[model samples]
Target: MKIAVIDGQGGGLGKTIIEKIRRELGNTVEIFALGTNAYATASMVKAGANDGASGESAICFCCKNVKFHCIIGPIGIICPNSMLGELTPSIAEAVFNADCIKYLIPISKHGLYIPGVQHMQINDFIQEIILELKKKLTH
Candidate 1:
């Protein structure tokens, strides 16, 4: 299955997620790193994404054209002008309007907070996503 792992800024989160997904799932899934900038995309690609793309236009076009099984990223991915303003309104709108399921990592940064998510560790959330994806793939 195709999975889009979107991230912005330094891409630390996407790097971690991509590493875990690689360790857990091996080469079974196709990972596409969608980053807000070239540096972020490069980071994820180094972490083992099968492919990658960057910038607002690339993100919007892919979300609308490609049929990924799911899109995974921070909650800011849907919030316009998020990611410290790296994510543009068009990018956010495209991601939100994409015809695919989205798995959001509850990041309490950028002045955004999600109740019940603040107590969980980042690794825990990544693990949960990997586990759920594994189950779905086996099914």
Candidate 2:
């Protein structure tokens, strides 16, 4: 299975997710780190992504071309003008239109409140994602 991990800003979230995925899944899944900037991509790549790419064009092309089993990222990936506008409209559109399931981590952002999702640590969210992936990928 192929999973795309998308992030912007400092890419810390993406890096952590990639690391956890690698530790839990081993080599069972291929991970691609898709970032809005080179620094973000580099961060995930250092963590253990099989490959990575940056920028809106790369994001659009990968979302359209890659047959990813899942796309994992913050909820911002679907929101236009997010990540201090690093995530362009085209990137958001491509991610929303991608032919893959998405697992978004609800973050506490300015003026955004995801109802019913209590604020949790990033580690907790990562654990949940790992559990979900195990349930789906093992079957």
Candidate 3:
């Protein structure tokens, strides 16, 4: 299956998620890193993503043309006004309106204010999401 890991800012969270998915799913899954910036994409690529792309235009193109089975990321990926930068309203809306499935890690209100650290442990959350996806895929 093809999966896209979308993120912004420093791309730390995206890299961590890509690593976890790679270790757990092995070569059975195709990972695409879609980042708001070059740093974010590079981070995931360094973490072993099969492919990586960045910038608002790249994000928009992926959202429109890529036939990813699932898009995994934090709620910010869906919120254009959030960390997604140039891939704002239009791109976010396209993603939201698309037919592909999305797995969003819920972030609390106060948590959004914190920079650097995520609201919850991304490792645990990503593992859970992966497991759930595995179950669905297997069934």
Candidate 4:
């Protein structure tokens, strides 16, 4: 299975998620680190992603052309102008329209909130995501 981890800013969140995924699934599934900038991509690559790419074009292209089984990242990924304006409108639309399951972490930087999301620690959310991914991959 191939999955993409999308993140912006410093990529700390993506790095943590990728490390946990590596621990849980090893190298069985390909991990693509899709970041909004070079620094973000580098951080995720160092954390254990199989491949990495940065910039709006790369991300938008991947979302459209690459066949990812699923995509994981903060909820902000589908929001244009998110990540302090790093996420562009085209990028958001591409990701939102991608033909893949999206395992989004309910996080927002500019007051966007999912009404049903529970109040849990970030690590807890990541663990839940790992568990769900395991189930999806096995079947």
Q: Relative to the true structure, how large is the alpha-carbon lDDT of every model?
A: 0.94, 0.94, 0.81, 0.92
Q: Which residue pairs in candidate 4 have backbone atoms (N, alpha carbon, C) closer than 3 angstroms, thus clashing?
A: none
Candidate 4: list runs displaced more than 4 Å.
Answer: 116-118
For 28-128, candidate 2 gives per-residue lDDT tens digits of 99999999999999999999999999999999999999999999999999999999999899999999999989999998883588777786887888899
Best by TM-score: 1
How close to the true structure is residue 29 of candidate 3, measured as C-alpha lDDT?
87
How good is model 2 by TM-score?
A: 0.96
Reference-based lDDT, residue 9, model 2 = 89
lDDT of 1 by residue, 1-139 (tens): 8999999999999999999999999999999999999999999999999999999999999999999989999999999999889999999999999998899999987687788787899899999999889988999
The alpha-carbon deviation from the true structure for residue 66 of candidate 2, after best TM-score superposition, in angstroms, is 0.3
Estimate, for each residue in 1-139, the C-alpha lDDT of model 3 and write its tens digit: 8899988878888898889888888888899999888998999999989999988788888888989888988777777767735448766886796568998776654136555445567677888888987886687
Off by over 4 Å in 3: 84-87, 109-120
Candidates sorted by lDDT, best first: 1, 2, 4, 3
Write candidate 4's Cα lDDT for 59-95 as tens digits.
9999999999999999889989989999889889999
Q: Candidate 2 — which pairs collide?
A: none
Stretches of candidate 1 above 4 Å error? none
TM values, all candidates: 0.97, 0.96, 0.85, 0.95
Q: Which residue pairs collide in model 1, if any?
A: none
